[model samples]
Target: MLFKTLRWSFLFTIIGLAIAFLYDGVTGVTVTAILIVLEVSLSFDNAVVNAKVLNRMSEFWVKIFLTVGILIAVFGMRLLFPLVVVFVTAGLSPIEAWDLALEKGNPDTPGTYGYILNDAHPLIAAFGGMFLLMIFLDFVFDEDKEHHWLGPVERALSKAAAFPGVSVLVALVWLFVFSRIFSEESADMLLAGVFGIILYLAVNGLGDFFDGGLEDELDDEGERRASTGEVVKATGKAAFSLFLYLELLDASFSFDGVIGAFAITSDPIIIALGLGVGAFYVRSITIYLVHQGTLSEYVFLEHGAHWAIGALALLLFVSIGPHIPEVVTGLVGVAFILLALWSSINYNKKHRGEDHVVHV
Candidate 1:
């Protein structure tokens, strides 16, 4: 089984490499590998969150996610999303974007690394800032008693129109309108922000709906929960649906990563290789989460993932108005997740009455 799985991964990797080869030879290979690592690092939290949702999906859908979903993520999102963003934001025609990407004149060529970097900075900042804000608000306003802190402003906001989703929508609409009053560039940036919001809401809504249905089924103690096979089947179905949702979420998260990469290099091959390798690690991480039952074992893992998501959302919002460093954005998110993981470990130790004991 392990060999078979490895074989499939190998095949996919080769295919990815082949595509990269078609674009550029050695440079393509090297860049693609780098992108894979970058993508994987940036998306570790994504895999964990995905596992949480996938655990409730069906077997067949899980297979599809591992196959078809992976293809879309590696190719469609990593390769094409950047071009789309450039086209939309930079007002470059598709052919213009392609030519600019493939042109080999100089690394410092106009619309090359330097130009793309300059053009992409605002978008990157907008994405990062939005992600950060979402994180802060979520951490502050979380309703769970164990996580709550009382602050006057937070208290006021909490009491008055407490729906976070509504706040996000209102903010997005405001940004959209604000952009129109400003320049076209600002409008494009704001549109990206709106897209990010819509993407998050759509993915989360679908996941929640599916989760609710599964919960309902599990609650039915009669025919639905009758046997082990039945339970497994139900779990598998839920896992499949969840896997699909998770893949979509992963794609959403990749938006910034994909676009940001263009600032470094426009070579489609390099981007593919680098991001694809990163995706491999993400898949491994997701599998580890699933096998370890991290969500169940570490009580706060899910909470942390949710916090990370909220942080990412804020990061996206900030991306609209200000320039934020991608590295900082990524680090802040990772820090929150690590903190949550550490807290979960501590909670587990305490619950097991092993907190006082030194394991090592």
Candidate 2:
């Protein structure tokens, strides 16, 4: 099952490595390998969260995610997005930005491709941070969420859901505080943050709007009560919303990594190839979790992924001034996931023993 699921990732890895080798021989290959590890480490939590959303999707949509979605991820975000950002922010034409990228100018020097991209980091961080923060807020503040990974903390947050728009209030407060702290860029930061919040609300509200009818057709456990054709139709619409949400979410997560990749290497092609492989692996992992029902088995896993997202959001905010190591970002996520997995295993063991005693 694992091999079947990850076959594409394996294929991509080989292709990415080959391109890297041809581009710059062994050194290129090595950097690309490092980038793959970097992308995977930073996005493991993303895979878990993706599985939660993807599980509800039909097989047809799932296939779409693997094919069309991968193209968007690899080329659109990894390559084109950065170029576009530099084009707009640095007042360069798209061709000029692309040429600069190919020239592989020094990242630290002024007026270079890398320098311009890094200069735009604050806006990127603000936008991505707020988007991710909204996600974290919605997950923790969900009143109907039965599972509690952090117990008292999560429960308290959930109870606070009684106050309408409390999450938005908290997010705005955070954004305000951070914007004040970085006074020079306060206006830009605020504008980007507000845009992020609005984008999240728009996408999430639409997803929920489309999903409402589908929900009515499902029982408590999410099995369909509607005819298969009806469910498929609903799923198609709902899945498109979800697919847009997922793409945006992935973009938010990729901002830091894409920026950080410049620190490692200035070669856009290498970065694209390496990170593309990692993106494929993340997709594969998402599919694997859905196929094997991992989230259902490891009940707190979703909670953990959200917590990691919260941490990443805060890290993005923090990274506005002082540089936080990519390693630090990656480790924080892995730690949350591991702790949640351990707790889930213990819970299962205790419950299984109780069930056995009752049976006896």
Candidate 3:
């Protein structure tokens, strides 16, 4: 199981080094290595959350997640996405945007790609933060959810789900405050945040709507069971919906990393190589969690991931106007993950002698 989990990790590392070596001799390799570590450290929470979501997907979709999905993650998000952001915002042609992305340490120039990309930081933060905030809120506020990792706090939030749109309301309120305090382009930030919420609602709504059509039987938990036949077809559709969600979720998470990569190296090729390889490893970890049933066994792991996400959301918003260390973000995520692992070990030990261990 361990080997399977790390199978692609080693491969990705090799690929990363080769790409870096091809791009910029010895220095490129060093930058790429750093970026890969940065990506993994910052995104461990993302992998955890992804595991929970990926657990429900069909086998075929899981295959897609590994195969075709890597392309989208590596190239679409890491490589071209930044260029696209710069192009759309700065009115730069594709070639021009690419060149600007390669340019390093230049001050803000009018209509330049670096200037525009940097300027979009607040907007990116607002969008990703609100979306992640909504994800955290929705998870913690589910009245149907019985597992409470934070005890009183989680229990209380779970009850709040009784109120419709509670998550959205909370997200929007926080977004408004962030827009005012953290961004000079306050209106743009606010608008982006609004769109973030809308996007979340749309994706989640579609998933829920698809779930209803997916199966005839509902288990004791009330989640639709993919029994067979038409239900199986619906499962495909549902998986597609979730796939889209996962991809977008990945995009939201990558915004900060992509922007941060520019600070490490001016070469877009190195950024893509490092970040893409790291992202591939993350995908492997998610699959490992799913296959090993790590999420079910280590109960608080999901909660810790969500909490880390909450932290990341706040960090992104805060970093919009301030300089927060990347190490800070990475360390915070690692802390939660380690804490959860410790808790899970304790939970396992305590439950080992029980007749029926409640797998919460």
Distance (Å) between predicted and true CA of 173, model 2? Answer: 0.3
- Report the Cα lDDT for candidate 3: 0.83
* Tens digits of per-residue lDDT for model 1, 1-360: 344434655666787778777877877766776666557656767877777656655666666767787788887877676667657656888888777666633445665632554466456544444443343454455444233212344355545346746557555665565456445568556755566555555655665676556655665553455454443333544555566556656776786677556655666657767786667657766766766677777666665666666666656555545655567657766876788788777767666854332221
**Model 3 bad stretches (over 4 Å):** 105-112, 216-234, 353-360
User: Which lDDT tens digits does candidate 2 get at residues 1-360?
Assistant: 999999989998998999999999999999999999999999999999999888778888888888999899999999999899989998988999999989898999998888899999999999999999999999999988867878778888889899999989999999999999999889999999999999999999999898886666556444543534343333656889999998999999899889989999988999998888999999999999998989978778888999999999999999999999999999999999999899888778767644321110
Clashing residue pairs, backbone N/CA/C < 3 A, model 3? none
Give the residue spans of candidate 1 off by over 4 A: 1-29, 87-96, 104-186, 206-244, 314-326, 353-360
RMSD over all Cα atoms, model 1: 6.0
lDDT, residue 60, model 2: 86
Candidate lDDT scores, in order, read 0.61, 0.90, 0.83
TM-score (C-alpha) between model 2 and the true structure: 0.94
By TM-score, is 1 or 2 better? 2
Alpha-carbon RMSD of each model: 6.0, 3.7, 3.6
1-360: candidate 3 lDDT, tens digit per residue: 878788878987997798788878899899999999999998999999998888888788988988888899999999998889888888888998888877754434655555677778888888998899889898898877646667788888888988988998899889888877854679988899999999999999999988777654345333433333222322467888999899988988888788787666657788889999999889988998988989978888998999999999999999887767788888998899889888878877887766452444
**Evaluated with TM-score, which candidate comes out highest?**
2
